[model samples]
Target chain A: MLTYEPDETVAHALDPRAKLAFQVAFAVAAISRPALAPLGVLSLLALGVLLSANLSPPRVLFGYRYPFGILCLSVLIAAVTIGPPWIDLADGVRTAHAAYGVGLVLLVSAAYVRSTPVRHSRAAIQSLVPGTPGRLLGIGVSLVFRFVPVLRRDIGTIRDAMAARLGTERSATERAVVLSSRGLTRAFVRADRLSVALQARCFAWNPTLPPLSFARADGLVLLLSVVLVTVPLW
Target chain B: MSTDHEYDSVALVPESIVRPFARAALLAALTGAVAFVSIPIPFSPAPLTLQVLFVFLAGLYLGPVWGSVSLLLYLTAGGAGAPIFAGGHAGIGHLFGKTGGFLWSYPIAAFVIGALVHGRTGFGFGSIDPTADETPSGGFFDSLEVRDPATVGLGRLVVALSVGTLIVYAIGAGYAMWLLSLSPVEAVAQFVAPFVIGEVLKMAATIALVRDGRYELS
Candidate 1:
């Protein structure tokens, strides 16, 4: 069963759209900077948001690790593969600085966004994207969110069946082949069904949409984003 | 040759056929549970999980409409802050970002697989509730009744599986291309190729199980 839930905190209260804009802006600004300073600032901001949300250290740390692993690996790959190599004792420093900076920004941005509520996030995205495509995108996002677990369960059932029928003694190669081919087929069939349902729901666009109400807090948050973003520019 | 005779005379009610929505949903929920078990890939951001196995089975077990609907429900729960995702990671942001394409393709992929399998006449008839007897001591292929060769043949099975596999790979590879910013060739090199062998084996097992009536929902 699904167990993630939004914490009742002020930081978690921002509209997902606003948070997304700010997070993207923060990440972009940090990325554009010459070095790691801006990224450090962004990380601090993420920490601040996490603290404000009153999320526990364990939960936040857990969230950080997987993405951090991806970020580190990517950075390592880039450092080895990308050019602009001017080496010395300080070479590691420069490479690490660039990699960590980009990695941290992306990770923090994802973390902040993930903590936000889905419906609100969708509404926010809908507001930002504009027109029919935007609405469709929202629906797409919604449907995907629902699909992951369902697919997970089916996989388990099939896996057990394979174990039973093919015997657990099947070679690794054989097991993998069976899993992937059958799994892919299932995914396609499920998609077809979902598409039909979505079509029936009359997912569409409204040109004259209702305006979003901006509270005093939204303004304050926007101002804060401006300040954070401008500091790098300054 | 008249085309009318080719079609089966079974009374088909679309609504009645579509009623397995809940079963599909249940299967999808189980899919999320499967994501918890991951095998590390030394060089990539993604880990190999037991997840895909269930995804295919969902299609086979639930058929197109219900299978996909089940996945949708799982995704909805996850996005709404349900911890039913890879490593129990869940939320709206996961739905919006880079890996979103792959995540979004789940239902589509499942439905395609399900529809393909459902098209095979032998695959469709195994709905006797296996859960009615929950003893794990039952032998492999216990509940299955091999279809009459004259009435339904394995040729259709091959055709259905081929089509279903194509759909799954199309979605997965397409998503990988977009997410990685690679050309089709490059994307397959990085994503699809590495996984192809494994996929093939999994499909065979899945096909066998479904053919043997292991997937018929209660």
Candidate 2:
């Protein structure tokens, strides 16, 4: 089970609404910039955000590498496919560099979310969808966290079962059959159980109830988000 | 934790009150699953998704209040860095990224749909006595019984869903135009035209499935 531990310094400090607003504003502003310099600055600020939250380099690296891979692919695609379709070295580098700038902005934004708690993230959403009941929102947050570990265990179980069934002499078709039948069934059964549990708990929407509050940290975050968006426009 | 203890807890609730919430959450997840049918859209960040169909279905199934709440829950999960987006990518930024308009409009779209279908004049599922062959049951009893499709037609339900879906498209198009800095006509040409055919097909399917009682069940 993945324990629900909120980081006091980072997660607890900011208002969920404020964090969401700031993130949205920053994402819009950062992605719109044509030049790499602004995004490069934002990438550095993502590092600063990690430092402020006291998150380790390894954690930051974990979220960033896939985006970097995407960035590489986007840049290569832009370089090879766009603008005159030439094999010229200079043109290739230029298009690739522009694509890299867009990718960098995307990477920084992902890092920000990774370092934040999932609960606060949900809170920001609550701010957007007016008349959302508090209990339903809370249950939704809980279910997302709850399901992750359940999914992880099911995957592990499937892998172990597959290994056991696939003896040294097993053919490829037999191995495929074992994986699809045993593994898929295990996953489906777990999902069905989860649905039944949720139903039993009376987890429907209660519209009259209000969502959780946004605190002082949320105000600061909102301010930062506004500044982030306006800075580019100015 | 034990099986006996879990069943004991489950046995306590009256089925009517408990059934709705369970049904709502399940429907929302199913709605998300339905939205995944659209693959590549050829152009535009917005894929031609079954999202509107399910959004309408959620409103119709959960009534006005819970239907909207389910949409909120789905958005919260997507915004919170779950890989549940089109082609499976997530983060708060995705809500503001190139395809931000569709993400932003979901809740409002759901609310409008729900509000349109927010009442029950009658009930379904064997509530009506099938063997009521007593010449319209005199006078007072006639008022209580369902009078077939003429009384509770599916057309009203389809109209309600369409209005809600239109609200989504309006918000989505408006946001896309502003974000992209395109003229109003240009935005419609680029963003709206591509998805029109698919959206119409989804609406027809949603109406057919909803009328057949494919909704409401877990």
Candidate 3:
């Protein structure tokens, strides 16, 4: 999985806010300029981002196989003509260019994902948006990150137990109902227990979060992001 | 442990908000976990996923406000790189990619489903008023109000889920068309048509799950 890993790479040292800005800027540049030349330059920058994060392009590509597959399929569908000329090469090329743009954007994000931790991301959000909304989002996001693995295990157990009993032979609706109901039941149970724990621990609205500061390198990254954001205008 | 610290200084999250928030977060996590559970359809390239089924349940169970909040948390967590998007793909990039439209529509769809199922009169837009009309079954915590989803009828659940499904497809197909520059017919054929069977199955599954009386949110 492409998640945060402890590393001393340059991308890892920068502020999460700077990285997030770069992602948004990169996405804007990729989406706005879909032509070959700009995309090629953006592709190199994206690859550079991956290399800086100590990530390989192929690993990221493998993680994105599903979206890539869909993009390829769309390209094929766009190329085939119903009648007359068998294939519209131009149409296929256009779709491919758009897909390539999306792929580049994905690559840039993969770098971000590999380099940044969830706590840093949460701190960035809490600081970016002030007051109650930010607090809710910051805490809620962490809660989700904590519980996804737990709930995933619960669902996996449900599936396994059902399989052991010959539940697969049941109709789709029955199996779905069985799985979902059981899944939901366990989730609520966990929620109830967790709520008690939070109350006991005095879950505060203003807890001390891990500090995030903009280092010297972050200034450079933000400047690069600003430059990327201006590409479409030029 | 630290009685010397000023107890009055800390502003604690109230029991009322804590319970629902925890439920919302868990439901969002459930939605993410289910994304990995893909069942293949014969001809279509994309397999059937139970993500939308949970979307419906989020609405039915959490109601309009918190249900939408749950989905919003899902989106944020996924964007922050939780490896929870379809097929374990995660990043801010997916939020702007071809399928971004469907992903962006989740909160709205949940809100719509919750409004329809709960039979709320107004648009309810972002309101977190759990005390509106539905009587809260006061638990041990005086502020905690638990509303049973079973109170809603089966027909309402079906209609609500159907409308939610339509919203997903409309936004998904429309966005895909604009992004990929596909004709309307082509977009529908490619994006919407293949998933009809899976969608129907999901709707049926959601309805069945909702009607089952064995489980209720505490």
| Maximum-DockQ candidate | 3
lDDT (tens digit, per residue) of candidate 3 on B1-218 = 43433454666666767888899999999999887886665565556688888888888888777889899999999999887888777899999888988998899999899888776431333323322313323322333233566777878778889999999999988887777777677678788888898889889888767666765545
DockQ of each: 0.08, 0.10, 0.54
Q: Lowest summed-lDDT stretch of 10 residues in model 3 chain A?
A: A31-40
lDDT of 1 by residue, A1-234 (tens): 223356777756666656666665655555443445556666677676656666554565566576446434433433342335632324334434544544545444445544565556556657776653355345445544566556666667778898789535765534554554455457656755764664465322332232355667767777777776665565
* Clashing residue pair totals per candidate (backbone < 3 A): 67, 2, 0
lDDT (C-alpha, whole model) for all candidates? 0.53, 0.52, 0.83
Local lDDT at B33 for model 2: 41
CA lDDT, candidate 1, residue A144 = 48
Flag the better candidate by TM-score, 1 or 3: 3
Candidate 3 per-residue lDDT, tens place, A1-234, comes to 789999999999989999999999999998774567777889899999999999989898887887888888888888887898979898887777777888889899999998999999999999887876788899999998998898999999999999899987777667777888889889988998999999999987777777688888899999999999987876
Q: Which ten residues in a row have the lowest lDDT in candidate 1 chain A?
A: A202-211
Candidate 3 local distance difference test against the native: 0.83
What tens-digit string does per-residue lDDT give for candidate 1 at B108-145?
77777665555543133332222232332332223222
lDDT of 1: 0.53
DockQ of 1: 0.08
Tell me the TM-score of each prediction against the true structure: 0.53, 0.55, 0.91
